[model samples]
Target: MSTDLQWLLLRKYNSYMVKGLPEGPIFSKEPGNLVNIHSHKYSGLSNSKTIDVSDENGVIQITTRKTASPHTIASTRSTSNIRARSGGRRALRVASAPAKQGYRPDLRRATLARVSALLAAQKEPKAQPAKKPRGKKTKASA
Candidate 1:
């Protein structure tokens, strides 16, 4: 996925799940469990299964696991390709080609009738003709 899409996914994921947790842990080498990531500063608890993330007063320690959220993987797979095209460029191209003149008469006739009528009106004599100045600039005819 593109960096822009990744950033968008990160933002969306953070908005829905990361506000309660510290900002630094979101991008850490190993993220903890949901409780660890969403706990306050003073909720300290350390063990082999969890890491202690404490703030400056030496009082608040948030417990977290060394794992990512289940939603992260699922969301990435779902939105990676979708967000790539939303960057305002050539993201999606139709697989089917436009129906040719003799390919589908029913559809072609329905569409071309309107187009042909418009074209015929434009071709009438009243339409402006291409011309140039006819005096000095005119070359002698052979």
Candidate 2:
């Protein structure tokens, strides 16, 4: 009888590294764990992209893609590291720093000048029209 089961695939590299020595990369397969799978998915490295797990004849097989080179993976990881280090909010703050540096003082000065002009205008006395003097009543002769 043929049975199908889900397995978790992992790409592992040799922990030991020597200068000027060729590195050996290894692939590992483990029993499928939902929690691990979810975590991997959340990390943006899912089955098709980074991990490769397959089952043949009720046995788990761990394999690596020939197209993905070590250099390419290293470059991709470096870029991700850079992004994680900078962070989203920190990058925004850095980008807006220059604009903010010169903006506030100028804005404050302009606001103060406008307010002072308005206050001066308000303090000036308004001109009024002169009123005509009323004539005294005169007695008329019949």
Candidate 3:
């Protein structure tokens, strides 16, 4: 997804980070460029992209990619494909951090963002109208 488009998706999902990283990965070297993602827990990469990291300065310009179309019930196989795509893309764009940086992502924030976004987007089903009460029976006019 393009920068504007990703922002739209985030809005649709409601101010939350998609997938499993808090606002995706951040490279200390650059401040406004994005890096791709792979879930260590799941053993694969994701198709989505991250925000751009600028210079050592604290500013960052976020961006994203389509990765996957709007599909419900995504299977494990397809999800794995997304992860691989994400990892490869990241490898190309950003250089890896030094060993001493000790990269540990903010999983808690990511989970909260995803859950809140999803819940807010969910629409409740419409309720049925109530039936009217019937009047008492009357004798025949004959």
Candidate 3 overall Cα lDDT vs. reference? 0.29
Clashes (N, CA, C under 3 Å) per candidate: 4, 0, 14
Full-model lDDT, candidate 1: 0.30
Among all windows of 10 consecutive residues in model 1, the one with the lowest summed lDDT is: 89-98
Q: In candidate 1, what are the lDDT values of residues 38-129, reduced to their tens digit?
A: 33221112111232222223222222233235466333211112122232222111101112323222233323332233334434377677
Cα lDDT tens digits for candidate 3, 1-142: 4545544443333322245456755222221112322222211122233223222122111222224455732431211111222343342222222111232232323422332333333335579897655554223322
Error of 2 at 24 (Å): 36
Better of 2 and 3 by TM-score: 3
Name the TM-score of candidate 1.
0.17
- lDDT of candidates 1 onward, in order: 0.30, 0.30, 0.29
Candidate 3, TM-score vs. the true structure?
0.18
Q: How would you encode candidate 2's per-residue C-alpha lDDT over 1-142 as one tens digit per residue? A: 1111111332222222122324543222232221222233311233322322233433322222222555676443211111223343443343233225552222233223322333344344879887655545233321
Which pairs clash in model 2?
A: none
Q: What is the lDDT for 76 in model 1?
A: 23
Worst lDDT 10-window in candidate 3: 76-85
RMSD of 1: 24.5
Error of 2 at 142 (Å): 99
